[model samples]
Target: MTDLSLYIHIPFCQRKCPYCDFNTYAGCEADYSRFIRALNQDILYEGHTRHHPRVPTLFLGGGTPTILKREQLDIIFEAVDHGFALLPHAEISSEANPGAVDQSRFETLRRLGVNRLSMGVQSFDEDELQFLGRIHSTGDAIRAMTLARKVGFENINLDLMFGMPQQTPAIFQHTLLRAIDLAPEHLSLYNLVVESGTPLATWVAKGQVSEPDPDLAADLYELACELLQQAGYHHYEISNWARGPLQYDGLPHYACHHNLVYWRNQSYLGLGPGAHSSVEPHRWSAVRPVGAYIKSVEEGVSARGYEERISKELAMAETMMLGLRLVEVGVDRQMFQKRFGLDAVDAYADELSSLQDRELVSIDAKRLRLTPRAKLLGNEVFAAFLPE
Candidate 1:
């Protein structure tokens, strides 16, 4: 049977960050309770068959899942337990903003079966935090980390961003050093992608803000990789690094199990407004508007706004693109032939030859993977998967 995962989206935030473009709203507490009820209803309506049992990984992602009160979280967790068959050792993770948590709250969540905590501590610099419109001060982030440790959180991940506006190498290095001192189990380091309609994008359009230079950003990325590597963190994926053995060993090694479902083209059900899901050939998403989602759910209806059945060729291309993100799960020669009925090496012979010639990829007897130098240019490598 194909392994499954669950993603529960909480779209409420205390305050929206200037750079964030996620589908989130402020002051939606009244609707939240009803939303949770509707979520449970929808889960039961979909029916939990033995063929596709409850997920092993339950990821509560958000605009800040920690924004929910302890009681609210309890209700959601209870519903999840009732609606699905949770594995005893399931990895239940919740994304938290630094300002949204405390020792007591962390303890409460721990008792509620949240085994992992992924904190959003984008940067350690006070000015950088302000620039990013984060709600918490740098001190609050540090305190949150300390408190998580004190509250007995064994698995913690820190989310950090680089390549922000006016970010200098020295400043980034300082942030890196501070992060290392904290020594979280996992780190997600991503470059800032300024989406249109965000405040940062507006500032850029008005000549008030400029992103860090590409060359400088590249330098910072390389430095981060080197520093994290020396700190005993494995650069497993392009952006994720972790210490020690794979936490979810039974699941995929490099890709986090929950996200791997997406990359590996497996089916999942997404709950909450603006949540996306792919169940086999079809892809669908709930209405992005919070009000509309609540209304539909109250009316005992699914809040679906869009749906599409992906073509076989498109799915195959996506598999290659997403699979290559991991350092270990390479393009297997025989597996590709079995799945797609085509030899990946022969099908994309020209592109493979070019990438190999450029030292971007290494091909052995059975598999193909990115070279260390090429991982930095992962986008360029993935672009080769696009149809010619």
Candidate 2:
């Protein structure tokens, strides 16, 4: 049976951060309840498929899943358990903002079978937090970490950001040091990208703010890689690091498993407004508007905005691009040949040789993988997979 992953989106937040463009509504409690009901229906509808087995990972992501009340979560969990088979040791993770957390809430989540927590602690500096328009203070982040530990959460991942407006190397180093002091089991160090429609982008366009220089951002990322490595964290993926064998022991093993499914070209069922899913040739996304999604579900209608069946060639190219993200899951020559009936090494000989000559890639007898330096320019490498 093919393993499946589940992604549940919660689109309610107390406030939307300026840098965020996720499908989220600020202070929409009534809409949240309706959305959860709709989500339950969608899950049941998808469960009729026999091709996919019980999901190994269930990810609750959103504006802030922590914003939901325990009672609301209980209803959603019960509905999901009824609609889909969950493995006994399935990894269940929820994304939470520091300001939305509390001891009681954390304990409640633990009892409800959430095995992992991914906290958004973008920065540990108060000034930087404000600059990013985050709702939490630096102290709030610390307290949230403490509460997670006290509430018996053994697997915790901290999401951090670097290269913000007015951010210097010294400031980023301080933030990194603070995060290290917290000693999270996993860390995701992401560079800030100002999306075109976000407030930060407008600020830059208006000359009110200046983004960190690209060269400086790269330097900071390299520094973080070195620092985290020295602290005994393995740079497994470009932006992900973990500590020792403890890394894959439990929930961390399933950390963002939904995303892993995408990387591995596995199938998934996504529910809730603006959620997306893929199953073999077909890909679909729900309507982004919360009201429309809920109304369609209530009327027993599909909420999909668009659906398309991908071609075999498209799927192969996608698999190559996504699988290359993992340091261990290098491109296997035999697997590629079996999948496409073509020898990858020979088909892309020129590009492969050129990249190898540039010190961006390395090839063993059966596999090809990006070198450490190549990870910094991953987009450029991935672009080679795209057709001209």
**Model number with the top lDDT:** 2
Q: What does candidate 2's lDDT look like per residue over 73-147, in tens digits?
A: 888788778777888988888898999999988988898899889999999889989988889999999999999
- Please provide, for model 1 over 305-364, each residue's C-alpha lDDT reduced to its tens digit, 9 standing for 90 to 100: 999988877777777777677666556667777878888788778988999999998888
Q: Compute each candidate's TM-score over C-alphas.
A: 0.93, 0.94
Q: Flag regions of model 2 displaced more than 4 Å.
A: 49-52, 246-256, 334-343
Model 1 poorest ten-residue lDDT run: 247-256
Q: What is the lDDT of residue 19 in candidate 2?
A: 82
Question: In model 2, where is the ten-residue run with the lowest total lDDT?
Answer: 246-255
Pairs of residues at least 3 apart in sequence or in different chains that clash in candidate 2 = none
